[model samples]
Target chain A: MSAPKPSDLAFVPFVSVENMMRLLHRIGIPDALTGLAAYIEEDFRRWELFDKTPRVAAHSSDGVIELMPTSDGTSYAFKYVNGHPKNTRDGLQTVTAFGLLAEVATGYPLLLSEMTLLTALRTAASSALVAKYLAPDGADTMALIGNGAQSEFQALAMKAVCGITHLRLYDIDPKATEKAMRNLAGHGFTLTACASVQEAVEGAQIITTCTADKQFATILTDNLVGAGVHINAIGGDCPGKTELHRDILSRADVFVEYPPQTRIEGEIQQMPEDFPVTEFWQVVTGTAAGRRNDRQITLFDGVGFATEDFSALRYIRDRLEGTGFYQELDLLADPDDPRDLFGMLQRANDGAA
Target chain B: MSAPKPSDLAFVPFVSVENMMRLLHRIGIPDALTGLAAYIEEDFRRWELFDKTPRVAAHSSDGVIELMPTSDGTSYAFKYVNGHPKNTRDGLQTVTAFGLLAEVATGYPLLLSEMTLLTALRTAASSALVAKYLAPDGADTMALIGNGAQSEFQALAMKAVCGITHLRLYDIDPKATEKAMRNLAGHGFTLTACASVQEAVEGAQIITTCTADKQFATILTDNLVGAGVHINAIGGDCPGKTELHRDILSRADVFVEYPPQTRIEGEIQQMPEDFPVTEFWQVVTGTAAGRRNDRQITLFDGVGFATEDFSALRYIRDRLEGTGFYQELDLLADPDDPRDLFGMLQRANDGAA
Candidate 1:
């Protein structure tokens, strides 16, 4: 007799890029961003239970490939991401990613997704979540210092999660600023195309620096940063790549995701090894203070963390049910008799014959 | 105008379980086994060039999930594998896996394939490859002490790669041995369902122990092993899951792949630190000797490594060309302008409308 057909356990739920886009649009981007922020905030609040590790990176001359993994005892997730700043010159994305979430009990994958889109969403959600906790009350206007791929998501997430209504966008390339402005046109925000970083931060309550340069160029010098503004420094995410000058970090009451990782990859990579910083989870847990006074610069060194990816994947897994936006991929081998893998192959061969 | 269709760069070739079995059967199992052995040997010979790291593992009460990643300068490969022995009780395979091969320069994935079958094939091929160098001359009869998922593949690989044509199989459950005998019925082998391990080892020139128990168990006792017989111990791949007895390891001239990993996961984990073990690559490179004497007990402590998985993925990638067994998965988000990802999403939204 031919081998029995594989069961549902053999198939993994796979969300392709098209499906991910469809799902986000189905849920409404603003609502999805708000949902992701809630999930991230919840995960961060219980951060003490997570298995956190600095991303395992393989660095080359041109770029880096990394595996960021985290576990919350019941579920596990990991994202395979690559950052190649030079890729844009070849008409490729500077960053590309995919992720998987698995059941911790059986060690079987539950979902496989193209995380290029999800990473963009989650990174923005994480930024907005932090801003909600630390930004001055009723913060509305923001300066977005990088009008690249992630800029629009940041702007919308800030608006949806933090009630920000105005965006001042700036980039070295005029075309990039024009692209961001176009993308945000109908998104219900008063958008500005600023000529300089100095002009962008003029009357804004929040400053989000998200440039994509790989070097340690100071996009936001100490002279440009103003008091009472919550600075979300995102671009300085790797060793030797800090967006802000050292003076801003010293002046700001810095908050970070995970200290061990932030010390190496976040903006704190520029500071001394023993530099004082607050873990964001502590602020969420009410163990530490956030934005004590209006004059205090609460700089969130927002290097993307594995837990954030885990939270994003968790959110996706939750939203995937009852939705026709995913495909079942025959990714696992589930023989009727688990011990008879070769026999299963032989039966397949016989069926083929 | 509608959004431009995704380019070829946005698609990653995915080979599912059905296709992997079809590909293997199309190539012929024996030839594929030999081919995989060749690829593994070639990678082993250049072992120094690989970025080797012990698999990153997350351990739970029941099992472990692991990520094994390696890069050989031009290409990078990683395998996601999980071993939950209890899974077999639930009619799931004890291990399931999937792997990806990507170009290191651009970090763009070239191929994604189901690896549960590939893993079985590779492990068997690796065992037979080692046996080729160390087994006594003109050896044909071999005792396979574990009749689990990997047994028949081991029997076939030995026949294809080394000139072994006879087999003696034994398992704690007599049904397991019966299953193996039935599976290998017409595979050009004289198969025997031995009553015990002692009966299985009778007059066998090679003894292969591959039992899968989470705890330490002496599948092969020191007194049962005879001189000049090459012993391949494979099942002791995790921290506490060893098969052979401690005395047998001390008596044998041990060979290992990547000592750092082998020492922690191999049968040699029972032995002390700084135990004398020969790196198998040295043997492949003609620097280390195999089968030094007729009476010497040569044991291959076969713990799987990332480079071996890398080689398997490399072989799959090379063979996937021109084969219609793969489907293109829209796994990457490729915006027209890398910096205008939001604009691309907006255009996709417009197209959907």
Candidate 2:
């Protein structure tokens, strides 16, 4: 066979949040969620193919900005994300992100995308995917404590992935719960707005806590957790920020994305350095057990990994192929004679002059 | 006065490369170059106020990808750049880049820009700024030994900033030299295309080497040395990539960007770990010696730092304020209610329904 031409190389397609929402609107959210979950699960099974590293974080007075980069030999990906919880007061999303996917062989960016919406979707999908293996059999009801921007996605993802039919929502802000209720109204799920975290967790099989505060507030104390409940800890995802109390984690069989990063940023940070935890990939690969027994409480200490972003990026790139919503950006220079980049500029100048 | 409300915070302007070029074309490249030099010098003077770190790199099979992040309390910036020398063979530029500037207090991305072109301009401006401080007085001739895409920019920046009026250019690829010659025509500078590196360096006050290769080949050996020549080593910017001979670096007074990074990626990478070098910021701040005398050879190992990109970004942001060429990218979510991000999707769904 002849050598593959440059044009034959895979080009990573980018999707802006607007374009992504449009695609989701066309494809419908449930289908998108299902597709993303499938992609994520397939990637997780190939655990050792990835080159993983703890995200490089730069801390400042107000919040933190991080670069989470990973590669699987064929492709490289990274997310540029920031967290400033106080941003909500200023009408800004507490988390904003953008990321790129590049071909590892050529180091050429294939996609440059707005990742804010995709991040929410992927985070929820990851939780639901893990819960498929870890959650108790026939789990239907989930307690969504700390209802916020991500609560609706979490609710829908659980419903679409793990057969969750009921959502017990509670939030310190009544408006947050109301917004979630309204958002999930016609999604074919029963929603009950509870008065307290205890009320929300009382009879639910799965508990998801996704608060947006940038602190170590224990949104789920040990006394509130029940037996056989699978806790999807989503929001407490940075150094000095946590949601589940140490006692709750101590009693649960904890699972994490990447142990090295989760130990520093996840709810598992409250545990000791030698605390035993399973990498979610191992469980996905069937190398480790997810839930030991029906009475055991399981915790997925989710801090969002680069691998998940890579999977989500690939999914979006594949899904948005013929969609016309994405604008062609001249993000890279494609000169007829690449070494004559100076000539390209000269041609532009000549045309103008 | 009462504290300004959160909603009253000013929106930062963004400038993409297409719009930045429009701004440059309107103001003229000469004026933009002058303005960029001023901004770079000003930022260098206040270097201590900024938080600086060596760029984080992810190496792959074909090339390397890197993230350069820095902040100055009020604003944070990071650039995602990749270098794939083999890319030129496939009709793509060897390097591609983009960056972001964000507000520190809220962690909101203020600007997202296409930096592929801006990087060339900024790298040239930074090298020239260093030459202005380190090159001896009355230096008006430059030897550009690598006549690739960046060679003309280097030549022009040196001419505009250091008053260099004559250029001797050489490249292994004769087409590249011809391209540089064409690009430099009518740019108010005298130029000569030479046959070899030695011919290019003959009797010149400054020498710039910017070859596009990812290896440790020594383009400049001790035999080509001359006194009082300021060497701007541009392309030896990654580990295992060095253009200058060890003896050249050993004898010359080397000025670098961040010392830790330069030690690993610059020409000094060939030297011992303890080799002493002065950071360019010190020379800009007048805290260290630049050139002791007219006969002293100096080398500005131009590895390209994040701070220079920060300066370029700020300059572009300021200059492109009124230009209508930029499209408002929906890169960040500005939810009416920050906690109701899911509601935005629901509303979109409702509108479609």
Candidate 3:
């Protein structure tokens, strides 16, 4: 075969939230989560190839906007996400995001997709991937605190990843719990709306805290957490915003993704500088222990990381190949002669002359 | 008029590279540069309203990929840009970029446009704006140290912003000088292609360094300096990159975009931590002195900041309003019912439901 023409080169495919939801429904949510989790693990194994940095955040009085970027030698990916805690009151999501994946060699965007829905899916997949190593064997019950837009995702991902069959949900708003219940209706999980955080955590094998608040509100107390229960903290992901009590973090065996970032954004921010924590990659690579003893409480301080988004984008791109589910965006120019950008414009002005 | 429905909300319009060039050609480059510079100056005056952050960058061995994001209270903007010094050898532009503007309240993307061309324009406009406040009286002759894709824009912006009439150009490649000469034709600038860097700098009151090499190469030395030259350093924008000799920085007064970022990425990176430098915004806001004496050498260490792009996006959005130059992007969803994101999938499945 001869060299491919510039136009023949594969442009990255994009799936909007509308199309992404359609893709998930058509492929089935469990299968999508399974595929995403597998990709996340594979990417983690070759972590040395990635250029990772802590996210750059712009803070405001109401919320924060963050740019999380990461790259392997061949591909680069970044996500634009914002957290506005008061958004739900105005009928908007507390978190909304979109991302781009590009070729590293040419610096061309291959895929641009709405990350709002994908973020929820990937965060849940990441949580469940960690729970597989940190949760107790044959874990089936999970306490999901804060049943908002992400609650159903966490419940479904845990079901697929850890075979969890029972969910005890708690939230400050009864309407949010009802929405989560309605959304998960026929998703094959036994749901219980708990009266308080303590009721939700009682006897659960795993606990996931994903409450959306911009302040340092303690959603999980040390008294509520039990031995051998793995806690997945997702929402406390910026400086001045945290969900877990400091005492809860002190007693648990902490695991994190990218220590420098976790030190600032994760629940571990409350602890001392020398706080002992295991990087999740080392545990996944079999270099460190995950759930050491049945009595030890394990915590996956899951402030969403760029590497997970990289893996999720890879999985979505691969799965959508030949599926015809995405549209081609003119994100990068394919000039007949790349040197003549001005010439390309002149031709475009003359109606694609 | 009644408030528009969420689905009918006006998108902040987009301008692609082709459309942007057409807009510039229609409005004329001088008018656009002058308008953009005005918008930048206005934004600099209200610097405290912006949610600003240092760019998030992923550096590879050969180049760098960066995401610069900023927001006013109403709109959010971000630009994705890449710089590969060796790209020209492969017939590619050294810099390529695109950006997005979004509505803050609804988290809806208002515009997506190619910024490879826009970045060149904005960088030059920002440099000219700084030189307006920092350069000596009636500055006309400018030394163009790198005659690459950015040289013509810098020349034109200086003409528009500071009434620069003469340009002395030099580059390692003679073909780059030829390209710049061709692009600057009919732009009303007296251009001289010099054989050496020293020859280019002779008697020039304003010097712009825009070399593409990603190294600590000193393009300007102490011996070449003049008494009142306003040096606009454009290419030494990332870590481990510097353009001016440390001796020159020690003697000249430096002005920067953001202090924390300038300390790491600008030519000032070669200086000590305690080295005194004034922020350009402070000078614009009259909080700091710019060019205290006519004989003082001043440097605008222009390692392009996010706010400039924010202003550029705002300016383009305003100009392209009635000019039918933008295409609507289906980047965000406006579901009839926000809660029915899952329902949208079912409708798509049913086809014309």
TM-score of chain A considered alone, across all candidate predictions: 0.97, 0.96, 0.95
Error at B286, model 2, angstroms: 1.3
Error of 3 at A14 (Å): 3.0
Residue range A1-353, candidate 2, lDDT tens digits: 01335543323345666777788888888888888999999999996999898988878877888888888888888998888887776677788888888877777777778788889899999999999999999999999988888889999899999999999999998888888888889889988999999899978999999997877797988998888989999984788999878999889999999999998998888888999999988998889998989999999999999999999988887777677757655565455676766566556656677
Q: After superposition, how far is residue A45 of candidate 1 from its true place, in Å?
A: 1.3
Candidate number that wins on lDDT, 2 or 3: 2
What would the TM-scores of all predictions be? 0.98, 0.95, 0.88
User: Which regions of candidate 2 fall more than 4 Å away from where they truly are?
Assistant: A1-14, B1-17
Superior candidate under TM-score, 2 versus 3: 2
Question: In CAPRI terms, where does candidate 1 land?
Answer: medium
Write one digit per residue (lDDT tens) for candidate 1, span A49-102: 998888988888888889998899999999999998988998899899999999
Which candidate should be chosen as best, given lDDT against the real structure? 1
CA displacement after TM-score superposition, residue B68 of candidate 3 (Å): 2.4
Off by over 4 Å in 1: A1-6, B1-6
TM-score of chain A of 2: 0.96
Q: Give the per-residue lDDT of model 3 (tens digit) for A1-353.
A: 12334564323356766678777777888999888899999888888788888887766666777788988888899988877776555555567678888778766677778787788889999999999999998789999998866777888889998899999999998877887787777889999999999999987999999887777899998888888889999874788778999998888999999999999988888887789999999888998898988888999998889999999888887777666778665555445444445445445555732
